[model samples]
Target chain A: MRLLLTSATSEFGRTVADLLSGDHEMVLTDQTRHAEGHPDVVACDLGDDDSTDRLVAGIDAIVHIGHGGHFSSASDLLDVNTRCTYNLLTAVRNAGINRVVNLSTLRLLDDYPEHLTVTENWRPTPGVEPVILSAHLNEYVCREFGREGGIKIANLRLGFPLVAGNTAAAAASGESAALAGDDLLTAINAALTADLGVNAQSTDAPHPVSFRTVHVQSPFENGRFLLKGAASILGLWEGQGVA
Target chain B: MKILILGGNGMLGPWVVDALGDRHQLRITDIGEPPETTHEWRQIDVSSLDDVVDAAEGMDAIINLSVLRPHRKIAFDVNTRGNYNMMVAAVTHNIQRVINTGPHYQLAGPSYEDWDFDLNPDMPPQPGTRLYAHTKALGQEIDRVFTTKHDVYLQTLLFYHLYDPGDIGNGPGGSGVESLGKDMMTPYSIAWPDAGEAIRCAVELPLERLPSRAETYMVFADVPHSKFNNSKARGQLGWQPRYHLESLWNKR
Candidate 1:
């Protein structure tokens, strides 16, 4: 598939592009202008509708990994994060792209009572925190698009995507919310290829919303967010050597 | 101060109107006719930008109490778009303060049956599958955006279940199946009077003293194995609930 990987300059976007390069044709983009010699990367700002439309025109699918950094002012984050995502979705619809992968955060489940196995179905505690609420609105954007039909969205609610060697230390520091790079790659790949079977009559079958939120956390014994539907939906547990 | 209470005709709206009416100049607006009240009442639909902007003119602050049933179209209209309209109107009119009412579904699991632990205001919102919760969560985001950009003070008070024990066996009773546990609900439910007090505190608290321009508080009476931590309301807003689940049983 020809894939559009947004925010390719960010750590997560770059890593995902590199990992998926072997199997899929990749188109990389970010808000920053691309270097002159790198013809393979497309310089696009998702906040601009025309730029987003041009970038998504020929792609078969999209991996939306862009976000305003942690230091952005609250208003800036809200505008850039939401407008960019909304713009991308609108362009995706106009461009006739059928599948999209939105990167949501595990922080949405951050306020749940500890030790209770958190599921995708848990309601997020509402608040005014800019980044977290932005993530929430992003999911709503995906849902709105999904409701419009002809689009399939997989929202991966990821934990801290840490470097391979640093995972142990981060986990040990009582923050059991870090995801290994390999796990993140596997989860995305599964999301890209999974047969959602939206028409199945069983209650467990994926709903017709065509938009699903799956928790993607490394299987830590004491992790705060539970990876309930990730294994069955994304096949993240298939060969990870974890249960 | 002139306070505009949007959705002031709903279930909890009357109680809030009663609580704050004498202390402040009150103006109530709702799509339906304003319930019998001496305060200035206007029939306005919050989803209409024109209506909200007109009603918001010269108001000191807005107390948004409007909510819609979980039906998809109406929920999106009244909760999501209505909030956007109100925020824009508030900013346009230079109204600096807005208090939004949201539900505790943000903390509750998929349903009341799946609830497990106490949630604090600092936690992220999880609206799950309910349309009402999802729209209300989106409205809270509108609050954040407007507060950040327009320098408005926005506070969202997320209420759990609100009910009077006296109404339990009288009319059309509570919804839910028989297998549902009372224990799961008792901790999260709030008496109507206590819920009113929380709203009053949110409206009257001095904004300059608040820790942040945007804030959220969980308002509920003290219940056993409660799923919400009310310390922020207590320490920040100086709010305390005089009722509890035991108060309902004790009345017998």
Candidate 2:
């Protein structure tokens, strides 16, 4: 499938590009003009409507790095996540690209205690930290677009400090919420191909719409966040961690 | 108490100034020049965090009336990032109270407006992709995050159509949408002065008296259609509409 990946120089950008490059037709873009040794990434400011529309044409799906990282300041975070995202989504829907896999983080729920079974149904009490709060804001924009029935958004909230190895290594790194790279790839693949509906992932919303949130984490047992939404909506299984 | 009013030269700003001008000390800020007022005014842009932070210093509370509907770039700047700057500045200065104003669609857009009635503000905001509603909703969401995380109180008063009591049918371009002859007006509509009064009510209400750290009030009057419910605002803020918009529902 043809895909457009945004923030191609941000955190985990190179890793995602390298991993997904062989499998699919990739068009990568970043706000910055140049990345060392990789010249194919088209420089397109996601905030600019003309640039985004030009970039979005002929794209089948999008993988948006929704977590607001790799920026200059708090203003950059606010603009990129809220304004640039709004522009990007508006351009996408206008261009008839209906599918988006917004990459968010599970840290928005880190405030909850260890014992509680935190799932996608539970609302994220996002702290004032710009990155986390901006991520929550990204989900809001995606949900509204999905709710409008113009797009089908699968907001995959991945575990933090996404590591590129087995779960054993990730656990050894001491970040309890670490997600293995393979699990991350699999979740994105599922989101890209899933039959998303208004009520696909969310069970608690009285009137669920197209935007779905799935908590994707590794070591599928006794993790900080439960995977009810990912299991049902993204067709994720425990074996996929090792598969 | 001393209050900082952002976008204090806009349409709703004067009404808010009218409501609170005599009672509380107000410091007004806007990108444009202000109306003739004895209170202090500053030419500030809300999208700039530095500008907002500087404007918000030493104030007891901040009231944001900034809104830009038509232009996309300026709209997002003023509407989306403006809220971000407000919250950050509020926390920076340790200001505890803030009152924000936006259209009702910011919380309940066409997703609710098209199909539902008795629409309250507590429902999850589903503001579909209309520019004004979408932009303003993002601001509200930003404000919600700051309220949850910081040592601050947020009160948002949402209004729909704004009408003048004397010029009910006589706004720009002759007979307006708020006329007496209208059979079915938007149930979320409120008069301009009443909208301002809602701000005063939000400001005066004690923080301890608030039911929650963050509260949103659907700032409409007692209309007949009952399409939107103002019970929360009425019960909590004790705000009653001084203008009788009987001509809207009762066409006598």
Report per-candidate DockQ: 0.08, 0.71
Candidate 1 lDDT by residue in tens digits, B135-178: 68777767776675577898888886887644542113433233
Local accuracy of candidate 1 as per-residue lDDT tens digits, A178-240: 777666777788888775436456576556547788887776666667665786677655333
RMSD after Cα superposition, model 2: 3.4
- Chain A, candidate 1, TM-score of 0.82
Candidate 2, position A13, lDDT: 77
Candidate 1 residue pairs in backbone clash? A123-B126, A124-B125, A124-B126, A124-B127, A125-B124, A125-B125, A125-B126, A126-B125, B118-B227
Regions of candidate 1 where Cα sits further than 4 Å from its true position: A1-99, A102-138, A141-191, A194-243, B107-116, B165-181, B247-252
Candidate 1's displacement at residue B163, Å, is: 1.9
The 10-residue segment of model 1 chain B with minimum total lDDT is B170-179
Error of 2 at A44 (Å): 0.8
